[model samples]
Target: MAMSRNEILDQVKEVLVDALGLDEDEVTEGATLMGDLGAESIDFLDIVFRLEKTFGIKVPREELFPAESLMNNPDFVSGGKLTPKGLAEFKARMPHSDFSKFEANPDINKLTDLFTVAAVVNFVERKLNQAA
Candidate 1:
């Protein structure tokens, strides 16, 4: 079965905490990985890699770094400063699907978790399959 949004978020947080050596309590749904977690550009990439590994998702570069969108988000100030509200807003803006049922015609909000997990898993599976 696929995971819920909350479940994915929790797992993301856990992977972040472990990879970044941060306190679990500090990594909340409203915490910005770059702002609150002091993640530099390279660190951010590391986080992304960890996220992909943990969640089995392959986040697109455009989704990861949308220059225009990032500039508009409140969490990112002139110098990439993130506030708690910004983090919350960022999380709220993430693409989410229900991941409960498989469907040919999916409602925007009713997408199965497999879709989300597949982003990462497919990448790994493809690579591994090719290797074999």
Candidate 2:
């Protein structure tokens, strides 16, 4: 059974709230996991684990967030910054993310700024669809 967008959002919100110890109201669709909800890298792991259990779907860490690997790649990072190719690949991988602000001065450190609650929902939807 394919879950609707709203269903996905609700499950994501619950997962985030549980993982981050946040209130339900703070887990809106527009909320950024790190910025708005205060999610750290470790929190991301917890969220992924919860999501996998809740949805019964497996999620590869690299598939969901490739920042760490990308940063280590010489082609992706040169002069301590993401190359044009790197930015393009990031955008391609994270279509649900809003890169308008980050496009001008892309910083790998600010990668969390791109992760919104909607992005997680979209990711879950894609994975569920693939499983179906």
Candidate 3:
């Protein structure tokens, strides 16, 4: 059976709390990842790695760090800042055609509650598949 939205969110929160060393209560859906979570670029990459390990997904380097044009999108954001809600919304909006097949698939439509763990895992898994 597929995981429930709450289940995914809870897992995402747990991953963030453990990986980023933040208190569980601090990681709300609207919290800013960089501003609130104190995650630098390297830390973000580490989170990506942890996600991949947890969910067996791969994300592309280009996708992970897209060009400025792609960066301009609200979904992509400025200053490496991402709100948990925004991240969830972006995942929900991604089309199947936008990503390569073979990575671990999570319920992006339910992503508003999905959080970063599943998304990061899906991204890293996609990258790994591309490299294979």
Candidate 4:
């Protein structure tokens, strides 16, 4: 049985609540895992693991959170912001994420802001749909 988007969001909220020790209220759809929920890099690994378990689906770390790879690569980032090519690549990689705000700044530091609860739901929704 395929889960609805709301169902996926609920489960994702649970996963984040447990993984980050956050209050359920803090896991709203627009909340960024890092900035809003105070999730560190290590928490992302646990969140991915929990999501995989909850959905019985694979959640590739790189696919969901590709910041590390882009950060270290000079070609992908320059001058503390994403290069034009990097921005394109980011948009491609995180299609589940909303880039309307980030596209304006393209600051590498704000990359984590893209990792919102809604983005996680979208990723899971895509994964489950793909499996179906």
lDDT of candidates 1 onward, in order = 0.48, 0.86, 0.51, 0.91
Model number with the top lDDT: 4
Q: What is the lDDT of candidate 2?
A: 0.86
Q: For this target, which candidate reaches the highest TM-score against the unseen true structure?
A: 4
Select the stronger candidate by TM-score from 2 and 3: 2
Question: What are the per-residue Cα lDDT tens digits for candidate 2 across 1-113?
Answer: 67899988888999998999999998888788888898888998998899999999998887787677777888887776679999998988777677898888887777777
lDDT of 4 by residue, 15-112 (tens): 99999998898889999989999998888899999998999999889999987787888888999999999999899999999999999999888998
2 or 4: which has the higher lDDT?
Answer: 4
Model 2 residue 108 CA deviation in Å: 2.1
> After superposing candidate 4, which stretches have Cα over 4 Å from the reference?
none
**Model 3: ten consecutive residues of lowest lDDT:** 95-104
Clashing pairs in 4: none
Q: Which order, best to worst by lDDT?
A: 4, 2, 3, 1
Task: Please list the residue runs of candidate 3 whose C-alpha ends up more than 4 Å from where it truly belongs after superposition.
Answer: 61-132
| lDDT, model 3, position 49 | 70
Return the candidate ranking by TM-score, descending: 4, 2, 3, 1
- Per-residue lDDT for 35 in model 3? 57
